[model samples]
Target chain A: MDKLNEILLNYADVDEIPDSASFRKDLGLSSFDTACLITEIRTVMGISLEPADFIKCKTVGALKDYLNTK
Target chain B: MIEKILPDGSKVTAFPISIPQQFMFFMSAQYGAKYPVNNIGLCCFIHGGADLEILRDALYEAISRCDTMRLRFTPDEKYKILQYITPETEMNIDIIDMSDIPLEEAKLKLQSISREDIPTYNCEIHKISLIRFKGNTDGIFMRLHHFAMDAYSTGVFLRDASEIYLHKTKGTAYPKPMRPYLPVLLQELQYINSPQQTEDKDYWFRSLSEADEPVFTDYMLDNRLTQQQKKNPSQRFADIHSGSPEAGTLIFSMSEDESKRILSVCEEKQLSVCAFLSMGLRTALSVFNNNETDVSFKMIVNRRGTVAEKKSGGIRINYFPMRSIIPGDMKFADAVNEISLIQNDIYGHCSLSFWDMLIERHKSMPSDAKPDSTYDSIGLSYQPPTEHIQLGSSPDEVIWFNNGASMIPLYLTIKHRTTDGGFDFIFEYRKDPDPVYDLNIFFTKLRGALLAGAEDPDITAHVLLKQLKITDEERKGKNNG
Candidate 1:
């Protein structure tokens, strides 16, 4: 599975991720949750981001690509 | 009636104490009224489903049980409860058609109730207004006497009424009040002359003495209404301009990737998300004020840890003013680390009252340190999301009451896990009496500063502003050129 699918399956409770599944709206992720997640991904995938960097990453797929580079 | 425990230790029912004493002795001897001391009530937005008759019935029931609701008091020491007063309670109910009434109209209607001319002990009840929308609903507005209750206590009363309504609708047994109002008043008076009274007085004296000269923030905004001025209810809601410069809640959403990044940062810094953000806020606010010497803000300790206190719950909070005094030569990270040290000591020495500390210091100082108002603003840890309790339905969609009173300049409320990784803040200010639009400007600068710091941990206020390009173009050109 790709990083995005892996994140969804491992962390989220839902089956079959929808296109509209926003980190805040669908996953019930708060600002803190987003921060922790970004920090974890940075360590797990060897990438780094600024605290406000998540403000730019809106979705799972989008986040996966951003992480792929760093 | 004064519950006097005499010299022999026997008690006597003495004559009523004066109204001010009633305020001083019964409620907290401290001015418990929300400052800008108008009518005492806060957040008085009414909801639909409230019938005028039902609300009236609740008020009548409350008045019938607590006759002091109608009894007016003179401020004199003779402690006279005057009998010749007119109806001390007043109410206004406006039936606002749902579609025609906008949110600002509703908010303005609620904001218009004033307490400038009200007697210290008399009741002021604005009529419950009705606003009808697609759903079958109504709204109520209230301006109760501050002497009678605080906002938290009033919320309890409203909750009781709501429960009563639900019970009556479903034909359930109506619960009785735990104790009568007058009996409670009498019980409270017993402590007035007790040995603990000295401690209480010392507490007040300390609080006043510690705050040498109160700092007032002037938010520039006009909120005064002309004698003949009419409110255009159709316009946008008027903002409460604060005269005080203060910082409030900072809210923003983060993405999954961003969340992970924040966690890594927290791990690297060995700080919770809240602590990290708080450090950032401290750094930013400290830099913005150009006061690189010291930055101070209060940290709230929620004492609701034990179950017994939770059962007969009262707001048991003691504020610790955490001060970060940076050395003349130190980096931002070093300043934050020092702030963390202050927080540790604050939590350790938290036993002493900030009020008492002031009193101890005041004993050595000369008089004339008192101010009309104290500290301009307070910093609060936000109400936790897990503990968020909605009393009933959210406030109804329409509001209309007609005494325009102003709130104190800067009242701040914050919610977040200080030990963990989340923070949200809310700031309330008086839009009308403000001389500078400080709150808005503060929030704007804060967001800029925090984000700038987040990008680079070593970022200073000057660097942050330079990064954001907030400096004058000419200055920038000169520096660049």
Candidate 2:
């Protein structure tokens, strides 16, 4: 229901994304998928972020915390 | 292995062409690649109007995101043909204002250009123009080579562009970039000699290993084959070894209400629209051949099952003969189910190389056998329109353009009209005299047979075709000699 999860739903096929799940290994999120997520996060969440911001966040929890900090 | 510098100074590194691209080249080779046989054009007429600047920016972004649209090809070598996406080379889209001319005349001008080849060797393989076709009735016309894009990919590209335009105007979500096509192409290219290839080959070869060859039933039913038969009594079947590539289209549309009625009937009978359509076509051919049961035609399968294949923009069309046998006593509804079962089996192994199967069948044929003479005179496809609406354009305003050539005698495409979800039966056929008259008769008979069968599922195909027989009134009225 959250903005991040809502956008992630569009890209990731899996239903539940645990905070500890690996973005690349578990969800199989390719770099292109990550780029789309960044765009969606900006447009849907109305937050601007960089690719490096994604680098700092490994799992779902880290990405959520980083976005919330903004 | 070849490197060249594009005009944009981008180093063009070539990758091997995919199987679909190889099929395209094989067809194009017939005309020395001079004819625009591989062209797919779309002209979307925006209802109110579209800003050229915004649409142009949107087109730019769309093309940039969908890498296949930026493809360029090298001339075919005996062993290797290559294509590359020039990173810096951009599509030169012109905003042509034909507002002063009548819409029909403006369309003729654009269509003339579409018929010409895009100079595939060391050149950009697509072209586009933003046209102002009188007042606020403007549209974008795009010409793409089939080597790089298929009908499905065109829809993806158009939907992407429109979504980008909406984002610029209404502040909607920024569109997602398309998945890169190269990965999809690489995966498919590996299908050539893989273990899966051998399994698929076995599936197809065994499925079509019937003792008897499917008799080619000419849909033209114009008696050209009948005449040929009178001349060559020993000939196995229709000798449509020769046909012109110059094409014309005859479109029959079912209104939204009528389409809904038929769709409801199909749903109630638990029959797919495609199966219902195939039954009508094959039945008509069967009746024309004196209730001869066996009928076959090429069915084009657009291979896009996964998210990766769905989002990737490139041609993934595989075509193979679909043969069906309908006895005279078979009920129309039952026939539809029979065809559906066959379709399911075909779709299960539709990824197998069509050329390989053709070779296996024809390798031992007589030396004089023209490849075209062996199987089908018709190819068929059904496209469902599911693209979400955008661009502030009315659905009726969207127009799809034919690339002005076809190798097949007739290619029938039944697609849901995006505007009203109606069915448009577009018959793309070569320009030959007998075809026009024959198709005129065939379309009327097929349409009636389809609707009546849908309305009454219990009607036997024999009864349905008997009713749909070319009325004497039709024969007397406009049966052009």
Point to the candidate with the largest lDDT: 2
**What are the per-model numbers of colliding residue pairs?**
54, 0
User: Which candidate number maximizes TM-score?
Assistant: 2
TM-score of chain B of 2: 0.92
Candidate 2: tens digits of C-alpha lDDT, residues B1-481: 4575555566776778877778888888876554678888778888678888999998898888888888877654554578887665467899998999999898887777777777777777788889888867888899888888988888888888888998998898887657888888888878878987888777776766644656667775555566776877656556664656778888888778878877788756556577788887887677566676888888887766555676789888888888888887989888887887677666656667768877755654446557656657778887755454546456525566777788677889988887788888899888864477777777777778778886888999778767877666766655446
Candidate 1 has an lDDT of: 0.42
**Candidate 2 stretches greater than 4 Å from native:** A1-70, B1-13, B76-78, B231-234, B363-368, B476-480
> All models: lDDT?
0.42, 0.75
Per residue, candidate 1 scores C-alpha lDDT tens digits across A1-70 of 2655655543343556664566655664433344445545555656676554554566666665666666
Model 1 compared with the native: what TM-score? 0.47
- Please give the lDDT score for candidate 2: 0.75
